[model samples]
Target: MRFEKENWDVIIVGTGPAGACLAREISKQHKKVLLLEKGQADLSINIPRMLKNNEMMFIGNGKTLVRGIRSGGTSVLYYGTAYDPPEELFSKFGIDLASEVEELRRELPLAPLKDELIGPAAQKIRESAVSLGYAWEKLDKFIYQDMCTPGYFPFDAQWNATRYVNDAINSGAVLLTNSEVTKVIVNGKQAVGVEAIVQGERHKLFASQIVLSAGGLGTAQILQASKINKAGEGFFCDPITIVQGLAEGIEAGNEIPMAAGMMFKNEGFILTDLTLPKLVYQLFSFQALRPHRVWQHRRTIGIMVKVRDGIGGSIKRGKVHKVFSEADKLKMQQGESKAREILQHAGAKRLYSTVWTSAHPGGTARIGEVVDPNLKSEYDNLYVCDCSVIPTEWGLPPTLAVLALAKRLAKHLLLRSYHRR
Candidate 1:
């Protein structure tokens, strides 16, 4: 590939929500930006393709960590649930997401699922929880309701980071797929560029500023490789398991997962309806040694028990080392019990819990420790705007919070660029 003599204003690694939003905002301001993604640009939701793109690693204690390695990152596989960023948490660090969050609300399609759009399984579970006085409520989703229908979860109806990536592209940002960045090239105290493998070829890209949005695990590895030793010292992956039971005469399994649920803040866990796809259901069933239930996707009703786990992990030599604390186990146990009670109340039977798995891996490069309140690393012109920068144990979907942070980072970067000129 021929080299461009001019350096870009910013180079963002990863196409997840944070990177996408940042690229979109920065490009809209007419800044020269380069976006790199390690995964292919394909966004297909089929089983074979997703499995191929999803890199699953056994972190520790038999628990697995999975994240999409394709364009749009894990948001392509997420349930599109939108949770506001914890204001107090950010306020403590001298960061506030109020303006960015409000701007996002005006831009994105975010609302609770309508009654007609709620699937039978989620409805049944909600009914049971409400009957038990648990205060289960409909969750806000990033779905375009006009594009959705009853009993079916349409992929296009759900919002993902790809939308922002496309917007960024339209605004003249350049994107390079299959480019895996290895490390940032720091000159003295300032980051000047990065070294990456582009389409299996080693490529060195230069930029005035480098922002790593390569996710929790990916960013930690790159930072460590770049000589930031404290990048991945400890982390948290909010572990989750589904407590499932068979409900007779309910045509379930096609609805959106996590559509309705409640948080047990005191218990340090959350419960939500989780109707997995047929393939995923079968995979979980086989993993749990329940071959008899492998074919019960249509009749299975499940509630996900996701716990706010303590930070006790490290990203070392391309592997995740993690273990749950005793408190984490107790929280999951209590959540599972609550889920089973709801299932039983809803006329479900043969309850069983699936193996533990985690989707969000974060707290690796923490805010106060690794990154500053402005999300800047110790080196100049380097920043991190992914789940890795979240300083606390987060149990909810972090798409909204990540997007908000990206917006804030974009404003800061643009202002800094203007000041430099």
Candidate 2:
């Protein structure tokens, strides 16, 4: 097959937060950047489109992993939560993101929801958990508060990476949607381009620098196809489940989810008040064989229990195979117990925990192994950024951390290019 004629200075695979941020920075410097996304660029929020964008993979028994395969990636489906990267985590690997994190704080809409924005379900759960001395409070969010109203969360109010992708395009970067990269085109020890399927046709796209920011599983699949045998060895997918209950006179179906929560650092889990979308609520309730409770979504109060699961999984042939350890199961159990207590304290009844699921799947192509602290792989000019590069097991939302890493990588690439010139 023939190669694309327009060679780029940098070819970024995946338009997730990391890739979008990097493309915006590089294009702003007048670099020839190409951003490729495996999914559609449509950002409409509707049930049919959302279900089509949401892709699910079965890892273990009754445990599934879900991610949004769209131009904005999973950020389109996330709760808009923000967690600062643990400085100590990256410090050990000789990387620092303090400056990038601070810059993002100024650029992005990051703050806790106001009292009026915090829904009644969240307020009741927070009160109960605080009364029990658990430090439950409003978690920081990446939301535009001016776009929201009391007890109602607008999807457009959430800050997704698509905005950065748009900025990159306006800065002269080329964005190709519905393009799935299969592997890197390497020449001996140097990287040259990528082989991808763009709208059902195979093509080779050349670039001086190639970065694989195709998220955790997607990146690992490409590395494996490129003969990187160790890319998909082990990984973590912050396992999560929701403890749901019926609370009389509580209307929570239309409220924002994950508005308030607390972290149990020692126990390796988190508890947050969650209000699932009407469709998701019905699906989960049906999955649990509670048909009678399906119509009670408006009165359902939910607490999400997310745990730091052990890393032991592989992505082979574009499929994930993982089994949570006994310890991971125990952590979930403990978290569910605590969530149950809080729900009961808030006068909820008939509590039930949903099946285990994971949204944050990462750590496969980790730093110190598949990639260096600079996020570069063994091949020259080939870098890996995103959740896959995170060096350790992480249970928190990774958007901010990945964005910081992308910023650092962008500066490194720009400096290297300037020196070459």
Candidate 3:
């Protein structure tokens, strides 16, 4: 059978934040770039109906998580909470994030949710944190204020990757959806192209530079399939546990935002609010069918904690092997106790824990371990720009860090092109 061969100046896999950002930067310089995704492109997937119906389950490494698999990737399912990358953490990895911060401020909306928008449950939590004299603050999220209504929640304010992907496309970058890259074609330890499955047929795409933004798991899978197993070593995720609280005089509704405030305790753990769909409450709340008097007290809040994980994990064949160390477990327990304390102060009547919940999973391809400081893999012309490249367990979410790295890598790639000329 005959196959078609296409050449591009650059080919990026995954249309998430990193890929979309890189594509946008490169395309502005007039580079012929192709962005490939394993899912379909749809912005409206953020709508409640779409998200609930097409939720994909990812289970491995002793945890089960759900996320959207469409064109915008997991952004469609993300709670849209935008957190600033811890500057000190990136500096340790030899990354300068100052300029990235400036760019982010210019491009994205970052502010605390207004008082009117904060639900009664969240306000009580905040008040408790203040009373405890803990260092806490409202979290800024990427959201469109205009779209928010009294009873309607706008989950898209967080900088969804779809916007960046669309910007890249508008800037002249070609996008290929429903294309799964199966292998990286290498010659003499240098990657020159990729082999992908599109419409049940095999096709090849060549590029001068290849960037893997295929996310933590997808990046590891692609690297492993290409006989590059070291990329899967040292994988780390901020193993999180959600503690839910039942409050009095509160109803089970979607008015509450996903993330509102955060408390960073001295015990090296962080606690924040957690919101879920109404269906989630119906399934988890023990008193779901109580009378209006009892149901009025069905307020639920979430506390997410990040443990100090000394033992790094691994990902093999789409399986995540995360065995918590003694220290990690201890940290989680400590965080849980603190969360209970906060709930008690906030007048929580009952508390329950979720089965499995964690948003950020990073370090699958750590810097200086799997990929070099420049994010280039041991294989030539192959690079990674995603949360997978984080070197250690960041106590906070990693979207901002991933974007900073992508911006820096784009500059590096551009300089290389100039030098070659």
- Choose the strongest candidate by TM-score: 1
User: How well does each candidate superpose onto the true structure, as a TM-score?
Assistant: 0.98, 0.97, 0.89
- Per residue, candidate 1 scores C-alpha lDDT tens digits across 256-299 of 88889999988899899999988889989988999999988999
Please write out the lDDT profile of model 2 over residues 152-267, one tens digit for every residue.
67789999999999999999999888899999999999999999999899899999999999989999999999998899898999998999998987777888788899989889
Q: Which stretches of candidate 1 lie over 4 Å from their true place?
A: 46-54
Residue range 1-421, candidate 3, lDDT tens digits: 2223556888999988788889999999998889988777766534355445334334454454444456666676666666667777667768787898679778876667777777666677778877997655777776775667655676564568888888888988988887888878898889999988865677888888999988877888899998887877865556667677777676535665544555453455677766556655444343333333234334666565655455366777766666667777788888888888888888876666554444556677888788888999989999999888888766566676677788889999999888878
Give candidate 1's whole-model lDDT: 0.91
User: Global CA lDDT of candidate 2, please?
Assistant: 0.90
TM-score computed on alpha carbons, candidate 3: 0.89
Clashing pairs in 1: none
How should the candidates be ordered by lDDT, best one leading? 1, 2, 3
In candidate 3, how many Å is residue 11 off? Answer: 0.5
lDDT of each: 0.91, 0.90, 0.72
Ranking by TM-score: 1, 2, 3
Candidates 1 and 2, the one with greater lDDT: 1
**Cα shift from native, residue 264, model 1 (Å):** 0.6
Q: TM-score for model 1?
A: 0.98
lDDT, residue 219, model 1:
97
lDDT of 3 at 98: 80
Runs in model 2 lying further than 4 Å from the true structure: 1-3, 44-54
